[model samples]
Structure formats: structure tokens, C-alpha cells
Target: MRFFLEFLEFLENMQLMLIINTIMKMPTVTKIIYRLKDEGLLDTRICDNDNRVTQVSLTEQGWTMVEKINEIASLLLTDSFTGLKPNDIKKLNEYLKILKANLQ
Candidate 1:
């Protein structure tokens, strides 16, 4: 889950270690990365300036998947709030923003 979200956050190529640090588990992150590469949704290469550093980026297919995932997430949120009033939704949005800011 963290891996997917990080991929969305960093759409361009990013250093492999940076991603691992964000997710906070090298073995698990490495496994997921290998699986994504096997699925042809991600690409990785060694950085030219630093042989010890590897870079990762999403493939075209991964971008398409991200779009679909976002669409589904939006639809799910709308459906979940179907019975809520407009003002209630607005309040909920405001509260969520506050909570997110606090987290940051």
C-alpha cells in the first residue's frame, strides 16, 4: 500500500534508497519492486553518476493503472457519502484537511 502511494507521489524517476526509506522496510519494498517489475509496470536502472544507486520509475502501463485507481477511489468516496448532506460533506472535508495537516 505504501509502495503504491509512493509511486503516485513520485511520478518521475526516484532513487531506490529514497523509496525504501519512505516505506521503512528494505526486504518488503524490494520484494514488491521486483514483483512490479515482473508485471511490467515499473522500470529500474543503475544511476550513471553513482554505480551504487538505483533509480526507479513507472512504466506507461503503470500510469494508466494509477489513473484507473484514482477514478475508482473517487467513485468509492462518492458512493460512501451518498446519504450525507452537502454541508456535512463540506464539514467532513474540512476536518479531514485538519487531520491531514496535523499528521504532516
Candidate 2:
């Protein structure tokens, strides 16, 4: 249960960072804006010239929380991949790639 929660945190934290960085750089996405606001991870402001447009920026508390979650996830990842032969590791990676492709 703890591991599952950690994994969830890992996904959420990565997603938060991706959204934050993407919003900082390129074209804005509605999903990112909704997610950030829904999660209370960031704030948004609408431009007057483009009322449909939103600008997103992370809050300090959000950054701190995501950072801690990322740290915990990193620790869990390091600890979880403890025992595996070389062939097993290769097979695992291959299977994961296949699974990801299938999902896409």
C-alpha cells in the first residue's frame, strides 16, 4: 500500500514538473491548466487580450511538496530494483517498452 502510494506520488510529481516546465516554455495546454488548478499545485491568470488564455506558475508550497515527493520516489526506485540478473533486467526493460507502446 505504501509502495503504491509512493508510485502515485512519483507520477503526480513528474506530471506537475512537466506541466510547469512546459507552461514556462511553449504553447499552453488546457489540460495542464486544469490539472494544476484542480490539484492546487499552481495558480493561473488570464490575459486581458486573450481571455481564453491562461498563464500558469507554481506556488512555493507546491514546489516544496513536489520536490519531497520526487525525492521519496527516487529513493523508492533505487531501493526497489535490488535483485535481478542482467538478462532479467534486459527483459524487464523490453517488456516495459512494449507495454508503454501498447498503451500509446
* TM-score, one value per model: 0.71, 0.54
| CA shift of 2, model 1, Å | 8.0
Best by TM-score: 1
Backbone-clash count (model 2): 0
Residue 6's lDDT within candidate 1 is 43
What lDDT does each candidate get? 0.75, 0.60
For residues 20-98, could you state the per-residue lDDT of candidate 2 as single tens digits? 4543543344554566567776676775687755545556656666677779878997777778777988999999999
Q: RMSD for each model, in Å, please? A: 3.6, 7.8
Off by over 4 Å in 2: 1-40, 85-87, 101-104
Give the least accurate 10-residue stretch of model 1, judged by summed lDDT: 2-11
Worst lDDT run of 10 residues, candidate 2, spans 1-10
TM-score of 2: 0.54
